[model samples]
Target: MSKMDKKRMKYAAKPGLMAALDIGSSKIACLIAQPFEDGTIEVVGVGHQVSKGMRSGNIVDMTALELGVSATIEAAEQLAKENVRDVVLCTAGGAPESKLIAFDVAIAGHEIGDGDLRRALDPTWLYARQNEDRRIIQTLPVGFSINGTPVRDPRRLYGEKLGVNMHVITQASSAVRNLESCAARCQLDIESHVVAPYAAGLATLVEDEKNLGCICIDMGGGTTSIAVFKEGEVIYTAVIPLGGNHVTNDIARGLSTPVSHAERMKTLYGGCFVTGSDSHETIKVPLIGEDDSEENQVPRATLADIIRSRIDEIFEMIAQNIKDSGVDPNIGRVVLTGGASQLAGVRRCAADILARQVRRGRPAALRGLPEAATGPSFSAAVGLLHYALAERQQTSFTSLYSKEMPSSRFGRIGQWLRDNI
Candidate 1:
C-alpha cells in the first residue's frame, strides 16, 4: 500500500481520541475524550457557550453559526492542547423521520451464510434514497428470521428463506446541507450526525428499559424531541418546535417583563406544581427598558401558574403525538433528558400527562468532568462518545465476506483467483 493509505489505516485503527460536538438551540458544547483499555472514556476537554444564529435547532445564519462553532471548538482545543479536524455531530433539526423496512430472499434450502445474508440486506441504501429530498442517517438491522422463525443471528442456521427487518432514520437534506456548510466554514469535517433524542437514549436507558420498552424525551431550547425504543432498538422519532424558549416567551408575555427577566424567573422559581406557600411568596419582575425602582411585584403562585400551563401543554402535545403514531405512551417508562428537563417538577408533570413513571436521565459519569457539566444537558455528547466506540467494533462487509477464507495471503489469493478467473 502507499504511504498515504498506510497512514490513514493507522489513524482509523487508533481508538484513543474521540470528540462530540452538540449543537443545540440554547447552547453549543464540545467535548473531547479518550477511550482507555478498561472500557472507560476519560474526558480531556470541554467547551460550552451561549448559542447564536440558531433557532429550533436549525442553522439560520451560516456566518454567525460558523463563528459560534469555531469558538466552541477552539475553546475545547485549548483545554486539550490538541487540535481536531473532525467531529461527531448531534442534530435535532431536519424533522427526523423513522420507518421499518422488511427484506426477504430465498436461500434454496441451504444453511444461511454471509452470501445469503448480504443478499437479504441488499440494496440497503437504494431503498432509502428513493426520496430526493431526504437522506438516510441511521440504518439498523433490528431483527432477522430464518424459515419464518425469528433469530438474532441466522448464520449456520438451516432455512429455505431468510428475512431481515431494518429500522431506518432519515432527515431533510436541506438541514443537513446547512450543517455541513457551517462545518466547512469552521474548517471542520463532520464524521457523523446522530439524531439528538436517539443519542440521549443511548446514554441514559438501561438494558432492561431498552429491552422492555421506553420513551425518551429530550427537551431543548428550541425543540422537544421524542424517541421510542423497543427490543433495544429505536422504532420511532418525533420532534416538536416548542421548548424551554416557548415557556420563557409565555412568562414574558404573562408577566409583562423582559425576556431575560422571564428566563431568570423560570430558572429560579419555575415549577409545574403549585404549593400552598406560593400565595404568600412574591417575586419582583423587571419590565423592559425600566429601572429597578419601577419593577413590578407579583405573587409566586401567578408565576408558577403561567409556567405550569405551558409545561402542561407541552406534555399533552407529546402524549397526543405518541398516540397519533400508534404507540401507547403507557407501554413503558419515560426517560427525560436535556437542559430543560432539569426544571423542578417537570418529571412529575410528565408522569401525570404521559401516564407512565418518569425518571430524570443523566449522562454516564466520566473522568475529568466538572460538577456543573455532568448533567442531563450533556447526555447527547456523552452518548456520541459511546456510539463512536461501538461503531468502530462493528464488522465490515469485506471482513465478513472473507471470514471463511484461509488466513494466509497466498491462500486468499488462490480463493480470489478461483472465484474471479
Candidate 2:
C-alpha cells in the first residue's frame, strides 16, 4: 500500500474519539474522551475558560465568543494529542421550550414494526414545519402504546393503532443559529445539540432517581436550567435567567464593592441562612473604585442576608415552575448541580422552599477525570460527554425526520419500510 494509504488504515483501526463543548454564560468547558468496550469512557483531555461575549446563555459578541471557544478547544486538543473535527455541544440559552406531542398511525391489525414506529413519529416533522421560528433540538419517546394500552416496546405487537408520546424540545431559531455560527467560526461541526439541564440530569442523577422521578437543577453563572426526569427519560426542561451571577451582583450592590470582590466574598462567606456566629463574624468590604486602604467592616450577617434573599427568590421560582409544569412536585427527590449549588445553605434552602428531599449533585467519576473537574460546576460538561456517547446507541427520530428523509412523501415511506423490513 502507498504510505498515505497505510497511515489512513492505521488511524482507522483505532477507536474513534468524541468531544463535547459546554457553553455556559459564565464559563466554557471542553472534554475529549475515548469509549471503551466495557461501556466506560476515559477522558483524555479537559479545558475550560472564562466565558466572554455571552449572556444568559446567548451569544452577544460573536467575535469574543469565537476566540474563547477556539482557545478552549485548542487547549483540549493539545492535551489529548489528538485533533477532532466535530463536537457535541450543550446550550442553556435560546429560550428552550418543551411539549409532549402525541402521534399515532393506523396499523389495521398488523403487527407493529420499525416502519410502524417511523410512521408514528413522522408527524413530528410536520409539527416542526408548522413552527418555522423554532428548531427542534430533542425528541424523546417517553412511552408507546398499542391500541391505547401502553407497552414498553411496541415492535411486533399486534394492534390496530400504534402511538407514541414524544417529549419534544425546541429553541428559538435565532438562538440556535447564533450558536452554530460561533461554532463554525471555531472550525467545529456540531455533532449534536443537547439542552443544558438534560445533560446535567444525565450526568448527575442516578438510575433510580431517573426511573422513579427527579428534578435536576443546574445553576450556572447567568442561568439556572432545570430538567424533570421520569421513567428514565427527560419529561420536561426549563431555563431560568437568574443564576450565581445575580447573587454576586446583589452582593456587589448591597456592599458597595467591586464585582470581583463581591464574587470572592460570596464564594467565601455567603450563605443562604444566618447563624448566631454571623453576628460576631465580620467581613472587610472594599468600596468600589476606591483604594485598598479605604474599606468598610460589615458583619457576616449582612452578607448572609443579601445572599439569602436572592437564593430564596431563586428557589421560590423553581418551586413555582415545577408546579406549573404539571408534574407532581412531590413525586421524587431534587438533585442540585452546578456552580451555584455549592454555596453554603443553598441545598437546605431549596429543600425548604420546594418541600422535597434535596441533595447536591456532582458528576459521576470517570477515568482520568481531574479532581478540580469533579465538582458541580463541571456537571453539565461531563454530562455532555455522557450524552454524546449514549446518543450514538439510540436512534434520533428528529434526525431521521429532518435530515435523512426523502423529498417525496411516498419516497420517504418507501425508504422507511425498506430500512425496517
Candidate 3:
C-alpha cells in the first residue's frame, strides 16, 4: 500500500462553523466565525466578559470562574443573537511553558513523502498522555531538517532519517479543568484549545517578520506573554505574572482608591512617559467616600511615573527572557499586542527598555474580519480563526501505500502538472 492511497481513503472534512474562546486574565471572550471564499474568516457572533475565576493567568477559584465564563458567553451570544453551543478555546492564561522535543526514525532506505512525515510525527502522540497537574496544549513545529539541510516542509523530502524541531507548550491540569468546567457551566463544549500567544502571532505578524525574526509581546490585564519567531517558527515563548492590571493595582494601593476607579483613571488618562507638561497637568481623581461631584487633583507626572516604573520592570524581564532564549541582534524588532499594548507610550517604553524597535501590531492584514476585530487587543481572538483553519487542513497520510502503486507516479504527475501550468 502507498501513503497517498491511504490518505485519500481516510480523509474527512471538518465542519464549517468554528467557535473561538479567548480566556485572558483580563477577560473571557468568545467568537463564532465562518470561513469566507477569499481565504478569510468572518465573525458571525462574539461574546466578551471580565474574567473572575482566573488571576495572573491562573485559576484561583472554580466557582468564580464558572460565573465569569457564563456571563461572558451569554453576552457574546446575545450580541450576535445566536446560541453558542460550543467553542475552541484559546490557551494563554496559565504557566506559559514552551519547550523543544524531537523524534528520530529509520526509513530503511524507503522513499519519504507526506505519509512518511505523518508516520514520523506519531511519537508526538506520547506527549498527549496527561496526568495530574499537567496538560499538553500545544505542539508547534520549529523546523524539519533532513540530513542537515533545513527544510520548511519535509513532506516530499527524500531522506534516510527525519529530524523535527518541535516546540511543546503545556499548562496546569487544574487550570485546564477550571476552564473546561466553566465552559460546561456556560453550556459550551471544548472542541480544542490553542496557545494564545501563537494565535496572536498568526493574526498580527506577516510572513517576513516570522520568517526572518520577530518577537511578539502580548501584554494583557494580568499577564504578559512573549513569543519569539524565526524562519516562520516559534523559538521561544514565556509568560510573566505581571501586566496592566498589576500597574493599576499598584496605583490603587499607592493612591488608596478602588479598583474600578483606578481602572477608569488608567484607561482615560494613564501615560507611561512624562515631561514638564505632565507635571502641571492636574487631573481630577475620585475620592473613595465622596459624593458624585467630589474629586481630588493629582499630578499627571505622578501617574506616568508609577506606570513607567512597572512597565519598565516588565520590559527588563522580557529582555532577560529573550537572552535566555538565545535571541540576540538577529531578532531585531518586537511586535506588541493585547489590550494593554493600546496604552499610550507603551511602544516607546518597550523600545527604550528592550533596546529594540517596538511596534504596536494590529490584526490589519487579514481577510474578512471587521475593523473592530482588527485591533491589537483582539489579536488572539482573530488568530483563533486562523488556527482553526490550519487545524482543519491537517491530514495524516502515513498509510498511503498500496502494493500496485509506485511513489514515482505522484512525482511524475506533479511534475507534469507544474510544467503544463
lDDT leader = 2
Tens digit per residue, CA lDDT, model 1, 29-50 = 8888877776677788798888
lDDT of 3 by residue, 290-382 (tens): 785877788898888888899999989988887786656568589999999988889998988788888888775554455666667788888
The local lDDT score (0 to 100) that residue 420 gets in candidate 2 is: 12
Stretches of candidate 2 off by over 4 Å are: 1-15, 395-421
- TM-score, structure 2 vs. true: 0.89
Model 1 is weakest, by summed lDDT over 10 consecutive residues, at 408-417
lDDT on C-alpha atoms for all candidate structures: 0.76, 0.81, 0.70
Q: What are the TM-scores, per candidate, against the unseen true structure? A: 0.86, 0.89, 0.84
On TM-score, the candidate that comes out on top is: 2
Residue-wise C-alpha lDDT for candidate 2, range 143-221, written one tens digit per residue: 8888899887787889888788888777776787788778876767777778999999989999999999999999999
Worst 10 residues of 3 by lDDT: 412-421
Query: In lDDT terms, how accurate is model 2?
Result: 0.81
Runs off by more than 4 Å, candidate 3:
1-14, 78-86, 128-131, 290-295, 365-371, 395-421
